[model samples]
Target: MGRIIAIANQKGGVGKTTTAINLSACLAEAGKKVLTIDLDPQGNTTSGLGIDKDELENTVYELMLDECSIKESMKKTDIENLTIIPANVNLAGAEIELLDVKEKEYVLKNSVDYIQDDFDFIIIDCPPSLNMLTINSMTTANTILVPIQCEYYALEGLSQLMHTIHLVQERLNPNLEMEGVVFTMYDARTNLSTQVVENVKNNLDTTIYQTIIPRNIRLAEAPSHGLPITLYDSKSAGAESYRDLAREVINRKDV
Candidate 1:
């Protein structure tokens, strides 16, 4: 069965979507079949993989409403082993539409039921806020991975996000686990970044990946060009860090 991992953080601009796009791409580059679901209505993951969100015929929104089969929504990305179930602004209304559905929280989980074994890994990019969409993702995910930015307010809102995860584990998905934390936007020149890392280590009782993603211009530029760092500039530091992170992610799971 494919391991379902949700890349989530209520805090924005922390490289949540960036990690989702690149990590999935790197995993595919490692010869693993990967399916990435864009749960965020913004659909950055979809576009990051070179899919035009506006032209999509089917999206996660349709899957949530039972308007289309999971296979029907899965679109091939430019990356060889990477597939995506794109989303759009239409998905913003899915929560309200799903209100009438029975056990709506499992909508995504149930949708993935038939396709669970089709890939080695299923990556989900969740919205920046905790809402029905996020709840649906957590219910489906085996683990939640948080991307914390190396900044002054790095620790802020994390407790609440953890609390929400705890509640989800308690009430909805007992088997759900924290996939631990990955630090993003690290600037080696700044002591503040290192301090934030140390502070988070001291405060949060979770596994912290040793692979730190640095603040790279190429990383920021790739998304705008609709290419992952790996494809846009494989030689860049951003691409190297994500590749390292991907190896770490897979090796950790192996152990």
Candidate 2:
């Protein structure tokens, strides 16, 4: 079965989508069959992989609603060994639509179970909120990977997110686990960034990857161009760092 890793953080603007795109791409480049699932209604991950979300005939919205099968919703991306199930603005209403559904938390988990054997990994880009969508993602995932930006207030909402994870483990999925936390947009020249990293390491008691993603212009630019850092600027520091993170993820026994 494929390992489902949900790239999540209730706090927005923390490199969640960026990590989702590059990490999935680099893992595919390393010869693993990967599937990227866009659960965020913004469709950033869909467009980031160079797929136009609006133009899609089927999306994650339809799959979650049982309007279509998983195979019908899957879209092949530009990267080899990588495929994606895109999401668009229509998914914004999923929270309300799923409110009264029976077994609501397991909706996504049950959908993904049928396709688990077809890929090596499934990376879900969760919405940046502790809403039903995020709950569904956590309930479905085997592991959760959090990306913390190296800035002030980086740990602000982490306590709530961790608490939510604890609830999911106790009430929903007993097998759910945390993959690890990785720092992003790190500026080595700033003392604040250094402090944030040290504080997180000391307090979290979790695995923090050694590779820190620098605030690279290329990393920011790639999304607008609808390409991952690896395909847009493979020589850039951002690309190299994500590649290293991929190796770290692959080697980790818990992952």
Candidate 3:
């Protein structure tokens, strides 16, 4: 079975989608078959991966509502081994619509179950909220990867995130686990960044990746150009850090 990891943080602008796009791309570059699902209605992941989310006819919204098959929603990215099930603004309404569906929490898990065997890893980009879409993703995923920015208020809302995860494990998906935490937007010259890392390390009992994604213009620019950092600027620090993070993700062994 493939590992299903959801790149999630209830807080937005914390590099959640950035990690989702880059990590999946890097893993695919390493010759692993990877599938990414854009559960966020904003569809940044879809556009970040070079897909035209606005033009898509089939998306996760359709899949969630049983209007389309998973295969029908899957789209190939510029990256060879990476496939994505794109989503668009239409998915924004899924929250209210899901209330009427039977076994709604399992819709994502059930769709993913049939196709999990075809890939080595499945990555999900969740909306930056604790909504029904996130609930579906938590139920579908084997683990959750959180990205924390190295700035003030870094540790805020984390307790709630952890508590939500705990509830998911207890009530919805008992097999779910924390994949790890990754620090993003780090600046070596700033003591505040260093202090934030130390603060989180001292407080949280979770695995933290060593590769810190420094704030790079290349990373920010790549999404606008419809490419991943690896393709847009392979030699840049952002690309290298994501590659290192991918290796770490594949090598990590749970204790």
For every model shown, the clashing-pair count is 0, 0, 0
* Residue 124 error, candidate 2, Å: 0.4
- As for candidate 2, its clashing pairs are none
Candidate 1 similarity to native, TM-score: 0.99
Using alpha carbons, what is the TM-score of model 2?
Answer: 0.99
Worst 10 residues of 2 by lDDT: 246-255
Q: What is the lDDT of residue 10 in candidate 1?
A: 98
Alpha-carbon TM-score of each model against the true structure: 0.99, 0.99, 0.99
Query: What is the per-residue lDDT of model 1 for residues 92-163, given as tens digits with 9 covering 90 to 100?
Result: 999899989999999999999899899999999999999999999999999999999999999999999999
Determine which window of 10 residues in candidate 1 has minimal summed lDDT: 246-255
What tens digits encode model 2's per-residue C-alpha lDDT throughout 101-207?
99999998898999999999899999999998999999989999999999999999999999999999999998999999999999989999999999999989777
Candidate 3 pairs with clashing backbones? none
